[model samples]
Target: MRRYLRLYKLFVLQYLKTLMQSKLDLAIGIAGFVISQASGLVFILLVFTQIPEINGYGIDQMVFIYGFSLLPKGLDHLLTDCIWWIPGTFVTHGGLDKFLIRPLNVFFQIACEKFQADALGELAVGAALVSLSIARGAAELSVLDVMLFIVAVLAGTVIYTSVKLIAATFSFWYKNSFHIINTIYHLNDFAKYPISIYPKFIRIALTAIVPFAAASFYPASYFLDRSSLAGSIGIAAAAAAVSGSAAYGFFLLGLKSYDSSGN
Candidate 1:
């Protein structure tokens, strides 16, 4: 564990050095992400202009959920987003052969190959929105609420990573699973609001199939005092544990089928 951590630190340093060579490009990318996130929020604001609330959630609560969703999503994007490149770029272009030859874990090697700086913009915006909602008295959190929110965020990050991993693992057979990964990942947009607003089938799909609701809706609902604390925490934790374990197991299984490109 210590060795891996040290190696990851080294990787981060090397990645930063590379990024520094193109600082302007990095800045533009981050700025683009910030603009994109702001646009989404603007769309939400426009929707609320026509209605008092969506379901039982007010504008502040909805924004809180949206911001809370970004925390875990941004963390996953920052840390494990390289997984998304695996199927389409790495495997298809034989870039994965280099990682397979390394002494380190292939997944670890892939993850450490690059650090996404654009995700910092998402994190910044997310924090700002959450702070805004809190300052407006949208939710009054106790110490336990704060602690549980942290846990929920961590669990949600794992859930996001796990889903991406599972989708990427499909590349072992498909050779490219970008479409599947994108479809599943984009489902998080629905999770930014209350799941109750959706149809029963969509609700079930978000909760049971993709489990995006577990990553944001359920956890944020609990934080906002819209759901039972124990139930929310339990569901989020269990979803994280089950999804993560299943995804890792699937990845290991798929790894056994990996065929080197011999490049």
Candidate 2:
């Protein structure tokens, strides 16, 4: 484990060097995510202008949920962005061959292959908004509550990684599962909101099927309402464990079918 951490640090340093070389591209990438998030925030503000709250959540609460959701999603986007390539061009063009042959874990190599600095924009905005939410609310948080908050966010990040991993692993069979991956991954957008606005079917899909709600609404609500703080965090942790285990299991299964450059 120590060796893996050392290698990961080295790989990340190399990637950072390459990333810094392209200043214009880096700025554009960060700006793009910031704009995307801003647009969502604008929509939320406009909606609140028309309605006092959505199912008991005020504007501040909405911002909190949106920002809370971004933490895990942004971290996942930064660390595992390379997984997208598997279904895009890697499998067909032999880009995955190196990862397969490497002595390191296949998932680790893929994760360390690239880092999306653009996600920093999301993280920055998210932290700012969550702070704002706390300023506007969350005034009674205790030390233990703060610790649970950290646990929930970390678990949510795993859920994000697991979802993406499962989607990318399908490339081993589909050769190009980018569309499938995108469709399922974007469902998390719904998770950024209260989830109560959606119909029962959609709610169930996010809560039980993809379970993206666990990464956002469920955990975010923990801060907003302390009625079930520990319970909420537990659900988020459980969701991460279950989804992560399933994704990893699927990834192993997918590897069995991988034929380098045979796609």
> How many clashing pairs per prediction, in order?
0, 0
Relative to the true structure, candidate 1 reaches a TM of: 0.96
With candidate 1 superimposed using the best TM-score fit, by how many Å does residue 90's alpha carbon deviate from the native? 2.5
TM-score, per-candidate, Cα-based: 0.96, 0.95
Candidate 2, residue 19: CA error in Å?
1.7
User: Residue by residue across 1-263, what tens digits does model 2's lDDT show?
Assistant: 99999998998899889988999999999999999898899999999889998898889989998999999999999898988888766776878787777788988888888888999999888888899888987435689978887888899999999998898888888776889899989989889888779999998888778989999889888788764865578788999999999999999898888777754
Q: How far is each candidate from the true structure, as Cα RMSD in Å?
A: 1.3, 1.5
Locate the minimum summed-lDDT window of 10 residues in model 2.
225-234
| Candidate 1 Cα RMSD (Å) | 1.3
Worst 10 residues of 1 by lDDT: 225-234
Give the runs in model 1 whose Cα sits over 4 Å from its true position.
Answer: none
Report, for every candidate in turn, its global Cα lDDT versus the true structure: 0.88, 0.87
Query: Which runs of model 2 end up more than 4 angstroms from their true locations?
Result: none
Could you say which candidate leads in lDDT? 1
